[model samples]
Target: MRPIPHPGRPGKLLRLLAEKYPTKEAVMSRLIYLQGQLVLPKGVEHFMSDLHGEYAAFYHILNNCSGVIREKVDYVFGARMSKEEKAEFCTLIYYPKEKIEQMTAARRATPAWYRENIARCLALARLMSWKYPASRLPGLIPARLRPVLVELLATRPEADAAQLAYQQRLLASIVQADAGAEFLEDFASLVKRLAVAEFHFVGDFFDRGGRPDAILDRVMALPEVDIEWGNHDVLWMGAALGSPACIATVVRNSLRYDNVDVLERGYGISLRPLVTFAQHLYPDEAPIRAAERAATILLFKVEGALIERNPDLGMANRRLLHCIDFRNVCAVLPSGRYELRKAYFPTIDEDAVDPYVLTLEEREILDGLVTSFTESPSLRRHVDFLYRKGSLYLVRNGNLLFHGCVPLTEDGAFCEITYDGKKYAGRAWLDFCDQMARAAYLYHEQEALDFMYFLWCGRLSPLSGREVRTFERTFLADKTTWEEPADPYYRLLDDEETCERVLKEFGLSPKKGHIINGHVPVKVKKGESPVKAGGRAIIIDGGFCKAYHEKTGISGFTLISNSRGLRLLAHQKIADVRTALADNGDIESVSETVELATIHTTVGDTDKGRAMQEEITDLYNLLLAYQNGVLKPQA
Candidate 1:
């Protein structure tokens, strides 16, 4: 067959391909490999949203792949393994080092026990390999053990007793070589990596919970991960950019939740200065409360100034200082005056020309915090990772993954918002916010820094659907005034037409595409379903934050999209790691299938697959160049 030359084939690009491929045979081999990969089953995807720094719960869920590991153990062993044995085995896989320590302490770390568990882990890894390409497994395993694992996995244990004996010899060799622990760790790691092809953290990986830093460390260690920047995440990002308002708000939230460990120890940020200042400033109140009050006042003052400087933010009503009747200790709202709950404004100069202006003490405290937040190595590392791997939204394999809503009006139209003399709504608004957020980090421009705070709580911010009522909730005695109304997007969640409109706005098909949302917790206790818009939209934030357990009626929700279909796992509360290890306790999850694949999903059907196909085409073009003498192939 005569090779038809592809038009506009740049010589430099073809030459670069030639250097890598070398010869026609090399190009053909790569093409064959890619084509084979195309037919492989799509890797499983685990979608989690609104983790809210619940590290222990996040740890278990992530390690267990939302209980898929246990389910697979059951599928593999069935009646041969008792329920207790399966649980123990699964627990070992989930927490290899801890389980090993437990077993060792109990005098249960027999050579036989190690061999048996290692064999089971290998079996599980082999089962997981069925969904992945042959080449993919080696990268997940340690280099030294890759060859041994591949050999053992190649043997059919069930079909051949001789092969089983061969596997037994390998396991025995590992134990005899004092490599049992190492092999088990690698196997456990391999199995977990294979359990989920990719992890999608839809957002809110900060706040409420005690260990967002630890959570970030775990997430950073994962093989594949993408994040949609949550409101809390952006607040931290803005703080990292040295925005005083954002820094104050972050400190306030840490104090409010009593989760300052993430700041003090995790990020090495000292709250001692603030605590001391608070103690001396408000000597009558308890230490923590005093500090929190100090933070709240600082937050309001800085946020109020930020709002005042930017009239475009449309947050004039949120300026709590101006609205406060300090003498009467009342809030002067648009409706009427309301009594203050605490009436504590010790730092405020009531007689000053501008109440929003920060006092000298407050200014010093905020400057220190901004310096700490921006200069802390750990905080900078984590926030940089957020910038590298996170975005406003991600469209992957036909689904729209975002942290919050597409701002919509009550009438189902995209809410038009004017900012910086430009009108934006829907996709454009999200894009603009994302750009400004990045600019805030990269350049620290005043407008971009201010916009970062706006994105944190602006009524039109896609990340924050509801206006934050921090001031009202903190000081207002009237519970009615504390109610922060949600954007119309929340009200229209169940409307299939609205979902379709949103999908269309993002250039996704309504029939096949889903809007995987976060930010709002799914109130399962109140008979609320995570599935909405007739399966067109799904809210995966079942609230991983322990504080929301009572309100959400579950630990969290995780969406698993694999070769066969899409399913949501509503995870029940996990007591602790001790309970899980000692009692063989697992987070009892209720699974709800959202969509079943019409055909088994393959690598050819995924976004990555499309990119691979383009590479294949380029290779074919290179092959034509070689045949036609347009480009010479290297030997």
Candidate 2:
């Protein structure tokens, strides 16, 4: 696999920009354009976290841009359109292709229907395009339809009778030509692009809800996106990098959640070999449980092996396979001896020389699984996407975005973690983890792979602040023994001083910089607020997965940051796509203004804006170089 290239350093980038704009005239023209863009309202950013493979809900939230589209619909149509009419119109924008197909199939898609919708779509696009510059609108529209649509959007159709009639004729021509569906699809794409300038997926795009693979496919199609690696996401990344423990854990999780389809249908990884092996070895257990049990054993074995090889991973305590007494059907732990959930361990022999070592059959099954996970084309594409777009943490637009905690010690300081004979904490540690994760994929080294697995559940891993007691939870009958304590970071989250320290460590303004994270669900039903540290940090995981809904008391949360500052949208349950198309079913999102910008924020105030300023500076230099005869212009 070709390694993904990192962005050039500032000097290198400036050199490249200078080369691109050779002449003084070209440099001046580019500088003027970029400078002009600085004052415009920065596009709205939509933040969602812990999607957990809920594709339908994710798709709807993404299409509707967290109710921003519906709000725009209301703003556009107002009292002229009734409630039902607005709902239908919004539904059309959300699922234009599907709605068009539905109408055509029902024999209700008349030329007049196409003309009306086309007009409405144009109106909505015009409204959305206001947030963006006119120059940017053409790029947002479909290439095939850009020339015609750009002309229509240049002026308001309702400005004069001539303009209105010309627009009407254009709409009619589209309908007459029977290209309304294609036109509407393009319009929908344009509107969606305009509605949200960027999407920040703050982690956990994999596991639980059955279609993380589908979620990734949708995310990949978006124009701009950044992902903060969640623990579950890192597990899959590790698996794709050929970590045997990670692969086993991925499979075990798939089986435990009854999400076998995600493995077999989604990624095309065959579970047949493991299933046949499990069923033959443990015939009395249900097939799924048997497979899960088999995978769990394989997981422990590999984890144990990894721990033994790399004692620095700090997971020696997790090698509990050696503590199990087969005859007694119990495991000795620090607390006490606990009875195993299932005594039938056909593959385990406590009397063996090394209990953590995989048996011949287990080894073959794991080797097959590793091959399947590492070589699956679909899985590779998704993992590549993750690596290309994801990191352990991100600092964007004066805010910090990460999937989990910053790893704080009990004394409210950044937790010091030792890795590769060096101690690192806070941002440095996360950066190291990110590099190792990339190295695991790029070099496929055993140490890097082990570190990647550690990021999934290591105690000090920024992605997973909790100590996962998978062994205890799976085998111990005592519920008391199953408690997995979270790191002190969780306890310190509500402390303003602690949060400020974290912000400062990341080189953000502690006074203005807010930490946005997701991993643990915020239980709203229990009167818990996602906002913590007096609103300096916000945890937006409200549970998109059905399994977490009961615990979180909300379908999901979306954070929107636009010119006006940040607001959070708490969504209720969204109906399936069928209902969305047929009945205009939409997720009802309650919006709360988290921070109202004291002054309207412009593109000049953003990270991108700062980068643009650098380019403008470079252009000025290039112009000087050309004028001084230091560099020649293209003839």
lDDT of 1 by residue, 331-352 (tens): 8888899999876677888787
- Per-residue lDDT over 411-488 for candidate 2, one digit per residue giving the tens place of the 0 to 100 score: 998878887799998889889889999999899999999988899998878899888899999888888988888999
Overall lDDT per candidate, in order of appearance: 0.88, 0.88
Write down the lDDT that model 2 would get: 0.88
Which segments of model 2 are wrong by more than 4 Å?
1-18, 628-635
Candidate 2 displacement at residue 530 in angstroms = 0.4
RMSD of 1: 1.8
The root-mean-square deviation over C-alpha atoms between each candidate and the true structure, in angstroms, is 1.8, 4.4
Number of colliding residue pairs in each model: 0, 0
